[model samples]
Target: MFLLDRPTLGATWGSTSADESRVDGFYLGTYTPDKRQIVLRDSSLVTIPDAWIEHAWSAQLTLLLKDTKRRAEGHYFNIPIPRQPGSESAYFIELADPDEPVMYYTVPAGWQAEFDALPATVTVAVKEKKQGSDSWEDAITIDTIKFSRAF
Candidate 1:
């Protein structure tokens, strides 16, 4: 079983002579076994770090699970961060297997728009860790996906 703490939503604004634009911000904190108290960490990169131009738009904690004896491969799941303003809400998820590895990732979902607006082929960074290995190899170029426009 996995538990998710309340997510946080932040925003950045850009202003010009005629218009103002809002960019969403996402930040995630830690989780606990019980729901009584949620602890916010000071060393969190998303919360303590500051940028002059960019910030987190949305954040969520994802817990991946699989049967160790039956499944040979792992899966990726994207949990959408709630658009709430405070860190009071909590989410819970239960998996069939408890021995599955627990991994934490801080992916900025709000940045998807910038990637979607790119033209044609896009170069992406890939990293992988071999089974039974303790360390992940350095990032390598693997594949590229091309987008088609129907105009």
Candidate 2:
């Protein structure tokens, strides 16, 4: 289920070292099917090209974007919903709008119990792997601190 609907308001997340060019964060607003676009501001709706994503709710959504550097984006959220609803598509969105190694997710077909989550809100900064490696990492998203969930 899509938690965001109107896509009109955003909660800005701030990071230290403003000059270092850190990845900025903001909670997206909402989406509208009739307008064929998603609203990202108080009253602004970004028209996502019709050819970009079809059936976003049912499709495995991954945004092709470039990361100036290499790393795995981190996220922390709880989906309490059981597996009975069937495996809907998850979206890997692009925020930086880069052009090199695009940002994406690698979640495979999950078990009914593996990702059973419900009614949870989370915040985390998705970070990449080692400086020289071509892999991604799942770091925790807690305020400004980083945490891990897997072994």
Model 1, runs deviating above 4 Å:
1-120, 132-134, 137-139
lDDT of 1 by residue, 43-108 (tens): 211111111111112223234432111111122222222222453222222221334334233234
Kindly provide the TM-score of model 2 when superposed on the true structure, using C-alpha atoms: 0.17
lDDT of 1 at 20: 12
Model 1 worst lDDT window (10 residues): 44-53
* TM-score for each of the candidates: 0.21, 0.17
Q: 72-107 in candidate 2: lDDT tens per residue?
A: 222212111112223232111322223322233323
User: CA lDDT of each candidate?
Assistant: 0.23, 0.22
Root-mean-square deviation (CA) per prediction: 22.8, 22.3
Tell me the deviation in Å of residue 58 in model 1: 11
For candidate 2, give the lDDT of residue 139: 25
